[model samples]
Target: MDTAPARDSAPPRTTAADARRGAPASRRPVLPYLLIAPTVLALAVVLGYPLAGLLLLSFQDMTRRELFSGAAPPWAGADNYRTVLTDGFFWEVLARTLLFTLVCVGVTMALAVPVALLMRRVDPWLRAVMAGVLVAVWAMPVMVAASVFRWLSDADDGVLNWLLGLLPGVDLDKHNWFYDPWQGFAVIAGVVVWGALPFAVLTLEAALTQVPRELAEAAVLDGANARQLFRHVTLPVIRPALVLVTALLAIGCTGVFNEIWLLRGGRPESDYYLLGVYSFIESFAVNRYSTGAAISVITVLLLLGGAVVYVRRLRALGEIE
Candidate 1:
């Protein structure tokens, strides 16, 4: 009898999915993380170091002497923080900053929503023209825009005064816009809103374009009026974008510096002191680097707290994972 040799059983072949399932749950793909490592490292070096330095500086008593002489400053622990928190003026500035930011964000959103909706309804050519104009305005340098606005509101020979002089009995010739803090802030707010509109309008319009046409048409067919359709459908679709724009505007307005500094001729009065301007005045004008750093830290903490609150709210609403 011929007996065939026993054939050795071949090992079972494993597919990628099978191997993945067999792998430890903690094991993740390394290539994606490796690819992003350089960027993360660069940002840490660029941003993290400065932030760390600021924190350290806030704890010390750094003066102009230490700055120019390259000598280590004396440690002051929490003195800077104590000084700022105890000052009534600091509270006023903080309150002013918050109120101003709220107003700017409110006005920007109010104007942006309508403009974006109008762009959606307008002819394509008109939309393109409007977009181009907005882009041009957005591209304008802040300094140049501020200078032009200054000239327009100049005490002598201003186009705005000239135009206002034409009104029935409103003589605004030789008007000093910066003399009154309220009027000065209004002008600054106008400039801020004008510069901000392009980005807000464009972002909202882009979000609007992502809205499902079928859903809108279905809502219209279901007897939903224009207001109802927007409230029920359009608003939900663009809510995320609106929130993002509003947050950014609030942060920007809170840190407003360039416009106020330029408009006030680089010497903002007590009435015009926002947080950023106050910090600048403390650091450079008064040579209190430690106090400035402390203020900067406080501003950062406030912003971070706001961000955390917004994130939690969104998560609670099931808007984010």
Candidate 2:
């Protein structure tokens, strides 16, 4: 009886290509690729090309003579790295760079967190005012910030010194901040922290405002104190933002040249020569493009390594959510 009548065959299944053809034009993959093409091209030209050239140069003794004369020399192998590593100044610069980055990141977060919390409670008008100030600070060109900080930190005819004189119990000297390495580090760190605060505040403020009211109410109902609620709930929710802020700060710190160069321009003998400064000196002062490239490559590698490690740690902690 079952074989008496043949069942009608089901409609043919759709292949991916057939399905794509039937899909809406806006949902096509080609449109997305076209939209992203310009950005990808720009990134390759600006970032990728330079990085490739720099890596190639790092492997050879690429002097100005050889470059102009078109006479390639033998490869130096890892000599450039060896020279950079064995130098005492390199170690000092590395230490200063790390210390500056760490301290500035900590100070920036410390300043940002309270401001973000306060922003959550403020009236709309005050919030707008705060946002305006932060935007203004963020919009200040990096070079302008460096110049303003330099003028303010000047030993003579400087506003900071003038302000110090106003204090009743303090007697101060016209200390040459740019001359002393420690003082220069402090000044640079302070400027970086100040410049970075706006971004950190904005980011953290947005994150803090997004903390669910239901969660806060539940915490309160569970007899959680203000400190406990903030420590357990608020901090965990904002951990992603904190990591992002630290990564940005670290990247910026590694490439700090303008401030140190402008402030300590004539002092290579001083202990404030950072890797960026070193790279600049090699390229311009010594006309050693290869050496400069090597330094840049090393800096980039270090930064990328740090980022990779941070991402791995984030994955390990499952904090991305």
lDDT of each: 0.90, 0.82
Per-residue lDDT for 117 in model 1?
A: 98
Candidate 2: C-alpha RMSD to true structure equals 6.4
lDDT, candidate 1, 183-240, per-residue tens: 8898888788888999999999999998899999999999999999999999988988
Q: Which residue pairs collide, candidate 2?
A: none
Q: Compared with the true structure, what per-residue lDDT tens digits does model 2 show for residues 62-164? A: 8778878999756988888787778787778778777777888888888999999999899999999999999999998877887888888888777887888
- Could you tell me every candidate's TM-score relative to the true structure? 0.88, 0.83
The local lDDT score (0 to 100) that residue 230 gets in candidate 2 is 96
Q: Please give the clash total of every predicted structure, in order.
A: 0, 0
Error at 21, model 1, angstroms: 18
Pairs with backbone N, CA or C atoms under 3 Å apart (clashes), candidate 1: none
Best by TM-score: 1
- How close is each model in CA RMSD to the real structure? 6.2, 6.4
